[model samples]
Target chain A: METINYQNFRIEAENICVDYNGKVALYDANLRLKPGQICGLVGMNGAGKTTFFNALTGFVNISKGKIRINGESLRSAQKDQTIAYVPQNEGIDSQFPISVWDVVMMGRYGSMNIFRCPRESDVQAVKDAIERVDLTDHLSTPIGNLSGGQRKRTFLARAIAQRASILLLDEPFSGVDIRTEKLISELFIQFKKEGKTILLSTHDMIHVREFCDLVLLINKTVVAYGETSEVFTPENITTTFGGISPDFLFGPES
Target chain B: MELFSFLNLDTFITDPLTHDFMRKALLMSSLVAAVCGFLSSYLTLKGWALMGDAVSHSVMPGVVVAYALGLPFSLGAFIFGVGSVALIGFIKQKSRVKEDTVIGLVFTGFFALGIVLVSKIKSNIDLHSILFGSPLGISLSDVKQTIFISLLVVILLSIFRKDLMLYCFDPRHAKTVGINVFFLHYLLLTCLSLAAVVGLQSVGIILVVAMLITPGATAYLLTDKFDNMTVISVLSAIISSLIGIYVSFWLDLETGGSIVLAQTFIFLFAFLFAPRYGIFKLQKLFAGYK
Candidate 1:
């Protein structure tokens, strides 16, 4: 509950490669992120954005290189519960009878000893997370009953409840409304000020230019990585998405 | 009036209670319902309803082979049920066949083989009883075995209930939290196998799938909370089983079939009358407005 010291938290992945059934899905990739920064992972579909997130979370094997978080290996970070992840929202069953409160409480399960009951602090944290997402009214409602935007916020609340120094979110804004997008943007700013390093994948270049401190453009490999202004460009967008249609690249920033 | 006469206390309840075999049948059926009902919630939540059916049917070959080898039928059924799951996982992973198609193929193939083996071997294992449970014929040892297996299932379920719920609800999140997804996966399957084998005697293989699915699903319609769902499911199963055994006695019907129907009837009641999720409630509200 104390104020977090953000300076020492960093994510460093060097020469990470991933192969699925002998097919090279991701090539040598290097990434370095400092605490208190919101980094946007930009790529087209099948551009390995999800794969990169999976690698950082230790969900998939990185065949060729190492990833370290806060000077520890990715595996160590995972074991110590230093990293929290919000996976892509497609596969979750909406009809599942879990409540919003229960979903947020799940965040504590990672850090708590397996057999131990949640402490008062853990319960308070879950309550705080749900309130932050403005889902206090829907605390006991089945998650399936929530609107798409509310559901998205529920997952964000879960990640926040995790209290991890580093957060990895995959496509958090997809299918959300403008108000939800604004709420997420504000939350990211608050998280950054609190010294949490956050990396999120998005197809919206406008959002990246507006909110991200750093941008990493990747297409099965690291194409560019630097300050958002420098990394996000027409040429970089063209290279990542190909020349099929440059309208999304050239569209005015929203 | 004649239909209601079957419920006469002296003729139905007292007469059946006087017989030891009927009492055992009632107890065994209730145990099967309690165990299978509890598991049905997880199976339905995970969208593994067909997988439950697949595993139940796939155990046929294993049961037949176990009989031929003079081994315990439950052991054989458990092995084959787990093997079928692994095979389905393999085929789903290895080939282009989608999971449902693969499940259909594997369960049918295993079932056919079981049928062939049952015909070829000279054994005391009644094919009819194996297909449709013989409640009246269950021995004392069978009763003891069912009790043991049901207790084990209940204990294991309680110990791992939280982790298993997390696993079934959101597996990827469970993995990130360092919950061994692999362990939870196999553990649930093992429990399912055990439940299937135990229920196979009371409901037979075909109806065991229903026992594994109906109670949980019926409870699902009644409550949004999982803990409540479990309690409701167990209660429903026991109630239905008791009713089923009594109904079977009066009508001289298959005990397993009667139990399954009782559970189904309960499900229909829940489906129509449940407060928030019921069809009849919604219809009544609409009709009131009209």
Candidate 2:
């Protein structure tokens, strides 16, 4: 619970710099995460947490620095199928045409080669993931029709189905209802317990502090880093929001 | 109706293509219509249909350049069209310029360059067909190109169907899943260019771009589901093609423009009258007007 072997890390970003156009989003951002850990990245808007995520998943071109997964750089981990990224956009409309089974099958695409389609075992993994998410009843329903919580569960199921050692989630908690958020946080913990390394970018300080092992305070630079309890202070929260109350962080009721 | 006897419906539908031109035109337009329907719905959903207009018209310079160089005109047009999408994409990311503004700049610039080239080369070239297509101008070579490219677009798209849809609906999420967002972006652009080029030879740029947009726009009025939108758009396109050809024949008008005109009619009707989703219907409900 206290520490992970730095040598067995699943993801490591060293002196990463990301820019959109000429405007740099992240500068000299360094992060490390071992398997069996959940690392929460917290920041204000334009804080570079998402940009750091963008670097890790190969979304934005690597402007500067290196990202490694499972002890290999993105190039090698990408080749080895040791990682999966859970995009915040994975939510579906209530009327989305695809079934639960089909949506989950997307996970296998990264694992499968271009020449080969998903195998039967791949489909079974999707079904198992759906069942794990407790979406068995709605497996055949269109994903677009699911509730917000269900949609979040569907994406969680997808990441689970990927069965990768590393999971990178971007703003997964935003737009999700509270019950689903709790369930998702627990699942991240479960993924960590199962030795999967999770690097999630979120604005919710309380959850990150409660659930994450280590925290990276990002704002175009590494504002702070280390244990969640140490990284999240009242001043840090106030500074990150730039005087805006952390209402979204605490919950809507607050 | 007795009108069928006077009109020779059997001769038109059953033995419709005694003339090679008619045969090629019908075959080509039908294929073009189907492909346009599929591509349009996806493009519309992703807000890329606007870019479709920009790129298709912007492809003018490429076509003119290719013709000037004596290379395949469509190839130049396609490369430029896809290039424009990539360019716009990067520009959107890199600059603070509004998207519509970028589209307008690129669209007008490329189209102006094309106009200049065509004017310079007007003595030797045929700009009429590229601007306003001759479905009847479809050759056996053109037919092969249309079929091959359309098939390629559909196959590539279908193979990566979910990926394409994911990218379209929410690229913010697509990047999270380890999917190459830019790769997929350009992939769709490439497919769009292929569709445009193939449709150009079979129909022409105006009708090709229209076909790639209107059917999907009309279908959006009918359903919210992505798959349903695709199916509805394709069906609408096929219907428009069949009816447009007949109407043109009956009126002794140009077939390609007639088909586009017919599709526009469909769009208008759908826009006004689609149940629950139509603008007119929504207005009626809102104001409690009959």
Candidate 3:
């Protein structure tokens, strides 16, 4: 497999807003992510975290403001394969007949030349990704037959196979078991060591403190974003959660 | 003895090939079935069965207009087929009307206009052929035309099969991988139109929709893997087309209706008896899940 040149990938968003049929879903959402850092996006339900991710990934049209990746606009960055995203609660249709290997192979489709089949390197990368996610035994199993945790790992493996410098995950740990979360954390640590940038959303504040180097508290807009130690305070938590954080604890015990 | 002669398998299979019209009908319908089966795999997977019906019916006006202008039927069919989809998209996006309602409105309106025009034109063209197929009337030129269009559909679909499968399976993932999902959407739509036009030659509008749906549906009940489903779909179509043509010859029935009946029979068999997904097995499957 050819070596992927891991450069200093950075994403900068300014005053991003998204409107869904006249209803505002996000407003003035701004954040900057530097390479080799893990940022946790903390937000309440319906707080536009997924919408923000969608805007950043160019999946949804940004009604206002601009986002740049590695100093290039989101559109251009997307064209160059600088970012990859894993959506939350991805319930693949039960009748879909693709295997785990094929799902992971799709990550290489973007980089492959038109009319050309997947090269040896592409196959190698896919194999390594599957093995990394501990899904080597289930390589031939139909994706729809996999358990929830297995499915999430399959998608994460796809992102790994994509070889993108920047990764955006929406609620990566939602509904997954503790073992799967631990496996993912280890993988993220390994990715950070290799200089890959990651931004993920989660409600697990304890995991956020343990794994995320930076935190972005959001509720329909940017509330606070900085190093985790400075930004993940009780006051920021209350503000981000719309005053619902009074019952919550600030320390790891909560 | 005479009443039971229709059950004679030897004559049933051999008699159809004796007449030139019957031979042409068999060849034309087989080609149509092959193409439709290939397309139906994706159509059923994506739940575009209704969309197939919409495009098939909506092409009626285009067919009539093509005849009036001396243009190719496929051209008119393709135009109107794509136009209906665009109209549906427009209404669904611009207004609060749901997609199914928009589809129902656009296709029926186009079909009604076609009926009015056909009634007013006073042409010698048989309206029955346009609505319900006239396989026995297929000429050498029609054979050439059908083969050309079917070949194009086959080649393009084969080359882009993987991409199209991924597109149908998970469009969001396809988009994330930098695929032009809009292009894939229209490409699939265009394929549906082409298949409809091609099937229009042998099965007409109503039966074309059947050919676009039943073969793949039957195959779906047979396999869990899509690649297997596609192969099974094409095979089922060819087998049913041959048997339908032969049975129609034996029974002196309408060719297109017989073909659809044969397809329906196969679907029923698969529905009741398939190993993994049949109604019988579904009981056991659900019990296991419980």
Name model 3 segments beyond 4 Å from true: A1-9, A246-254, B282-290
Candidate 1 contains a number of clashing pairs equal to 0
Q: Per-prediction count of colliding residue pairs?
A: 0, 7, 0
Taking the tens digit of each residue's C-alpha lDDT, what string does model 2 give over A1-254? 33545458677788989887788888898888777878888887777776777688676777888887766767666555566766665333444446666667766666665533778888888988888878899876767667767877787788778776788887788888778777787787678677888888876666687778888777788878888877677667656666655554575543
- lDDT tens digits, residue span A1-254, model 3: 33434453488899989998778999998888777889999888899988888788877889999888888877677667778887676545656877899889888888887643899999999999999999999998987688878888988999999988889988899888878888998999899987788999988888788989999989999899999999888889988888866355454442
In candidate 3, clashing pairs total 0
DockQ of every candidate: 0.62, 0.25, 0.51
Report the alpha-carbon TM-score of model 3 versus the true structure: 0.92
lDDT of 2 by residue, B7-63 (tens): 676765755556677766777788888887888877877767777888888788898
Q: What TM-score would every model get versus the actual structure?
A: 0.93, 0.84, 0.92
Clashing pairs in 1: none
**DockQ, computed on Cα atoms, for candidate 2:** 0.25
Which 10-residue window in model 3 chain A sums to the lowest lDDT?
Answer: A1-10
**Chain A TM-scores, candidates in order:** 0.93, 0.86, 0.91
Tell me the tens digit of each residue's lDDT in model 1 across A12-31.
89999999856788989999
